[model samples]
Target chain A: MAMAAFRREGRRFAPLLHPNSITAPRSSLIPQELDPEGVRFISTQVVRNRMKSVKNIQKITKAMKMVAASKLRGVQTKAENSRGLWQPFTALLGDTPSIDVKKNVLVTISSDKGLCGGINSTSVKMSKAIHKLNSGPDKETKYVIVGEKAKAQLVRDSKKDIELNITDLQKIPLNYTQAIFLTLELVLVDKSSQAGLISVLADDILKNVEYDALRVVFNKFHSVVSFMPTMSTVLSPEVVEKEAEAGGRLEGLDSYEIEGGETKSEVLQNLTEFQFSSVLFNAVLENACSEMGARMSAMDSSSRNAGEMLDRLTLTYNRTRQASITTELIEIISGASALEG
Target chain B: MASNAAAVPFWRAAGMTYITYSNICANLVRNCLKEPYRSEAINREKVHFSVAKWVDGKPQKPRDEELWHGNHA
Candidate 1:
């Protein structure tokens, strides 16, 4: 990460070191080439200025590392707390019967910026692999990308069609409501359409149309140093139905029980929204946490590289200064001896 | 003292450029760890386990083995 920073700095600084800027003499004390003092002074000043700038950069990077670390800690806690909710939800899904549906949707979450390591690339590759595994030429495969980086990569490597491309979600509050809204807008447009009904009712909604299957591709945060790209499948309505038909009664299922003032369909709709919302929320949060972790690691490596460069440059500067002083001393001694002779 | 952001005119002047780069790198690592690397490893392990079942081989799950050896036995 530090390297990425350094490269960017180098690019920015390159233009500042133009011949016109560096070569123009600011002092009238001596000729440009013969005045070793002036040259040394200017060179040393430039080096010092550069070093100061780099030092400031290091400080900022360090602070950012700390911020990312704190955010990661908070996100991890949230993710853990939500796991309890996932258990009951998935259990309900398991109780549903399976059906034969023939479409797949993959919602991949990635980051907008680069330098965190291989997060975006990895996500794209995994999505491709999943697509390969689940989709045939005739099968309907669609994608809903969450981050800018993911969208760009998918677009570049697309051998199949993309159904939806969602960007700038980082600024939005990732919640169940947002998930429902997005799904409703993008995937659940036509109520009577097989794809729309299956997508809306199968995974999170109160088991409406049994979807063939639904999958989410995202990063799962493990620790500061470890994370993994994960693909989670929500049991489609068909699967639920099949399970229910095969001695798996839907009577006692969580979805079947209606709360006060809610019809069965209404309750199903709310649960559907909640389920979709949770999945989307989890994906976004996990991705954000992963981004922070990657940034931290990348910065750590960058700071180390900067330290190494500083060491080498300081050594070079010392040697050059020492050589110049030695030559001056030798010239002075020789002149004194000649005068005495 | 004036706030750093206010004092520094450009992003470079504020010395946030390095931070930006670091953030970028961190993002990359985070994404990579979550996506291809983690998924690939998990998928491979699943495939291996399936193959082991067919071949009558012992299924040595990494996490499970680590837990058993380090935490329990």
Candidate 2:
């Protein structure tokens, strides 16, 4: 009967009773290396420091997400505006046959910076697939890499295939003037054969300078949440001409006469140059939008992961603090009882 | 429109702006006309420093291909 009463009293006082393991040892004058109180103190300190660092990380990720979101709005508008001009332009070339030429060039468009998800990887993969399909003994496929991220990947697999690796394109927001200048530079490097082919009497000098075909690989932004890598093939002037002739658009041509002074070939050259600029500009715009979307999604996931960690750490911290307080209260109550006896 | 662009200087040619000329060039290329004529029509557009210059009579800048190979020469 007496023991049963004591057990009931102990249960009632359990909240105030400090667990003995947590209470510092009063009997021992010197603290041992394995002291329980010392271990708890060290653990609490470490956990607190860890929590603080995690909080800082969460703040950074959150800010990054906001920045990406704002940039996304501007790029999305630019992509849409370009699409308006590109649709009709593509339609004119839609019936054109793929050009058959000895050497083909593949331009891979990606951003120089990383921290975005798979934007770079997808561009590299698309280029590889096109490179594999086009590579043969009879014909050669040359790579013109536009960004560092894709260059890093392609250099390992197709080191010899890479004719030119261009970087620093993403230093500022892309503009039409930059696109035009880049097109001119590409024409200079790739059309190196034109000088030898040019003759004072030769009527076909312009035709000799044209590339057979160009394939541009880039990530296309489909929605706010997703991006798909795509390949756009642009045919040479010869093929485009053949397609238009075969499509029986001559009736349309018969109605309009060329200005008396302008010869037919001169007009064709300007059209080809303009088309080249528009196609390249479109690819760059689409790639920019995809990069922004990818970064936003990546930062969002990082912030979520940090939040989960903080929740778990806070739970542990609260439980440990409550247990320490109980241990101290029990130690005080036992001391008072001993003194009373 | 073709007759009008032919009569006047390119700048004074009413409705013969860069955009209109672009359409004309695009149409000519689509027809697949023979040789130097097709090539020459396209090169006629010469816009420098945002100013469209009459390149037909003026001394031309070195063509892109010429500049490229000329560097090595």
Candidate 3:
């Protein structure tokens, strides 16, 4: 019965017994010789340290996930609400001739923080591709960067190409006013300059400028987890005119009426300018929301992965502890038996 | 331990008051237990000590006791 009890105990502590009995070619072959107490101490220390580190990581990820989710909700709502308002405005301006202007402008947006994974890298890569497509020694592309990470990447990769870098927009209020200001500052200022400068100078700037068509590339948020790079053209006057004519026919419209003291030409010009600002604002808001959604999904996945790791490590700790106990019990019983004999 | 206590912010010090109170109670039980099993129980108790303190509404203190217990246990 005692032997059977010993056998049962051995079975219970099989992990501990099996390792000791696995014959090493020599004592030197054993990497480290540790007593049961030593093994228990080291294992406990390792498990405790690892668990603490994992818990800390999990806490940070959880906080980031919550922050991202809150931001995503706010940004998504704003983007959706503004989309309908901007669509009609864009359609109205489609009839004007594109300002036969030549200026290259690139706007890039990326996340401020890392750990949400490849969002920043993807944005940077897309920006580089856009730069390659648009700019050369013969033709220069001006840049307006949003987010610190994107600004840093652009400066590093294409320093000569960048004209302006704007970072930390999240700290400031993002609104239509800001978008209009950016558009005026980046695109309109030079284009609106000197109708009488060297006609060739004006023509050179205006000819290649294509100021009316604004091309913006950004990640479009499909869901919390997935974002795809999407490019949308904000029409110059000529394209807008075409779109408006198409739209006007669909609406069974003949002439767009302008109320008050302005001529049709003046009203059209004012409306078209407002339309350009609206498109820029809408695109920026949409891209911001998409970035937040992508971050939320990435952090949530990281938190879940940390939990799984903690669970596996916990199981290993328990098994190791049980093994240590069993081995200790065997050694005590064997020592007592030897003394009695 | 003194440096840690000194470094703790006022809010965290208030949290630590609750943590210390609960830990004292737990240590009373742990100190009274026998060896081997005593160490194991203490170790297990320590692992959960911070969580217990957090549950009781204390925040900002590192779960030192629980972590110590885990290593020793």
**Best by TM-score, which number?**
2
Which regions of candidate 1 are displaced past 4 Å?
A: A1-50, A94-101, A189-211, A243-273, B1-73
B-chain TM-score of model 3: 0.37
lDDT of 1 by residue, A29-147 (tens): 21233323223222344445556666777777777778777876876776766666556766665422122246776777888777677777888888888877766667765665666
Question: Residue A327 error for model 1, in Å?
Answer: 2.4
Q: What does the interface RMSD come to for each candidate?
A: 22.9, 15.4, 30.6
Q: What tens digits encode model 2's per-residue C-alpha lDDT throughout A42-130?
A: 13555677789899999999999999999999989988788765576565554232445567888899888898999999999888987
lDDT tens digits by residue: candidate 3, A1-341 = 34333434544454676754433442331122332422332235556678779989999989998998998888887788777756785354433222222455556666555565677778778777766776555665555565567756666656655544444445533554455444543343333232231121232322122344555656766777787775555554344445556664323223666566544433343444555556656767777777788777778888899999889878766765676676778879999999999
Model 3, docking class: incorrect
State the DockQ of every prediction: 0.01, 0.03, 0.01
| TM-scores of the candidates, chain A only | 0.70, 0.75, 0.70
Better of 2 and 3 by TM-score: 2
TM per prediction: 0.59, 0.65, 0.60
Docking class of 1: incorrect
